[model samples]
Target chain A: MFNKDNQLEKFKDAETIIGASIKVKGNFQGQGSIIIEGSLEGSLKTDANLFIGDRAKVTANIESKDAIVNGEVRGNIKSKNYLAIGGTAKIFGDIQYGEISVAKGAIINGQLMMLSEEHKRNDKLKPEEKAVATDK
Target chain B: MHVYIYDDYLNKSKYNKTINRIEIRLTDLGLNGKIIRLGGIKNIKGTIQNEIKLGAKTIVAVGNNQTINKIIGAVIDTDIYSDFQKKTILGIIPVGGDNSIAASFGIKNEEEACNILLARRVEKIDLGIVGQYYFLNQATIQSLGTILEIDDYSLEIIKRGEVSIINLLSDKNQSIKSNPHDGKLDIYIKTKRKDQTYLSAKKLLITNPNNKLLVDGVIEMATPIEVGISKDRVNVIVGKDRMFE
Candidate 1:
């Protein structure tokens, strides 16, 4: 959905969707945003956003640029950018995020760590640092 | 060094002027090649084989999407094409119907196609393969009770709609980075609901007998088919503003 300033973020156009009836059990890594509405038992990693639908059940550690969770997650979540925990979300793992927004009814059973500004900046510069180190 | 394969439909009386204009443009651009009018769709592979044997380095398909797929199929079948892989390049001069493939390559018309051929800017692109057939664009299956298996993921559809395995993003305005050179196919399964979604992977296996598999808008095969990417498969001449990038 394109609005003024083009800042609208919707997972409607997600490149990958894990439907409600399917179950995945492997290390899932890819380039594009992924939507999960089913069951997953793997380490999920992506440089794009991750959307967990309300009916979804995920049992994996999620590493993503951004994430919006409304389902059940049994592992740690590391959002490099923004993480939104919806009202229906039942998260049972430690959370680490650059920026976080949690709804009233969301349940988090583990510690929540707001990433420090210095850490965020360092995370942003890791690629450039690696490039520089490689040049040496 | 170019061999032009014109579709048989161009031989109709109404297309004489259009063909003449194309030929004149080709001559004016100093990019004239051996022109072969296809007698029928069945003879396309054999005609291409004859032209390849005649030492044609570039095979320019002058027709719509179906004609392009036929030429592509001939080129990829090593048993028939006989080792013309890296040596031969494909070009398109869109003549009729929905020529999305030509538009994707940034060739608008006959003159632009000739210009691209003259420029000789060849890009090695990936192609979607279903059995022995090679498709330049996406392939689709429209039916209910279908299951799509890609890599380690499997999606079962109970409602009827369409499942598209996209190789190159046809819509220019589409923001997704679905590239033909990326060696990955974008699988989009659109059902009736607005909420149901799917993902992408390599080596797709669609299991169902109730649907027809359409490659580039033409019904080529049935369901229960396997789709995979053939990487760096074809060298194709593309316009300066080619869409695949």
Candidate 2:
């Protein structure tokens, strides 16, 4: 079993928290980390990592350095470093990531593309660490 | 010079004991200055402005939130707001009920409040401005049929919700804190579907037909209101337990 706490502990430092009762509609651009537990309808771009809670319903194109999603998303997602789709996630958009993890029971209905980088950077990623999906 | 403005309500005999104690403490610390009684004054704003012009460096509110609210309302409206932004400071000595504003400053009781004043640790804090009113806390606007126009985008709430633009929270909730030092204001929306939305904006425009923006749970004004930060931040004496650094 994945240690959910270990996966989410880092986001506790997240400066922006969208609580479960809020529904926002706007292009959100921020430098600080963000955690979404509510609904977003526009676009999201951030320099730091992003976390989507299990019950979050997002309809925004998301761009982040790192992302972990365990909710329902309906737009495209691009992560420069890493992307993790949890078991309960339901995604219906294209994805771009340097490294990716999709746990069992997660649903995706879009194409996935690996971000292009130098060969030395790609070589640093072990064979066991690239596209580590439980079942795709 | 420090000027202590005591709220009119504090004039009631019920509060005589606390008032006497506070006066003694202020005198003991050699921090006492001119005292203004609000009950006898007709034009509070003028009184505050007059004190400012006469070289009162520190303005202290000696009652609850309502007391500080009135004093702040007066202070921000004066011309001195722009000229001496840092030279003048606001202090709070929470005397009676509804003093969450003081607690947020890390001040607990009147005794500690005096000590905090003596220490004179100051911080620049933001305030939410709407027309003639300035709020230290948050502004609540009814979500129904409200359109919030931010810089690059607009937001509309289809579902029932409460929209608040927060400079700082009134209560001390460790769960989440809205930083008063941040130049941006936090936009919070709570909907009926158990959905919550949180974002921050530097400035925004609120358009609501026949609705008003309730500022700091005090003043009410009609909408198409432009809400933004005060052009100049106010210096406030704060304690270590202040909600924001």
Best prediction by lDDT = 2
Score chain A of model 1 by TM-score against the reference chain A.
0.85
Q: Interface RMSD (Å) of model 1? A: 3.6
| Predicted candidate 1 versus true structure: per-residue lDDT over B1-245, tens digit per residue | 88889888888888788789889988998888798888655766777877777778988898888778778777575664545675678888988668988888888887788788889998888888887777878888873677776555456665667777888767687444577887888776666555445566778788777767888787678768899987878888899877767
What digit string (tens of lDDT, one per residue) describes model 1 on residues A26-127? 677768888888788878888888888899888889998878889999999999888888899999999999888888999999999988886676667768
Model 2 agreement with the true structure over A1-136: per-residue lDDT tens digits: 1245676776766777776655668887778889988688899988888999999899999998878999999999998888999999999999988789999999999999998885325434556654453122
Q: What is the two-chain DockQ of model 1?
A: 0.31
Residue pairs with clashing backbones, model 1: A16-B199, A17-B198
DockQ of each: 0.31, 0.31
lDDT of 2 by residue, B53-88 (tens): 788889999998888788777767567665447567
Give stretches of model 1 more than 4 Å off.
A1-27, A37-49, A53-66, A74-83, A92-101, A109-136, B40-43, B79-83, B173-175, B192-198
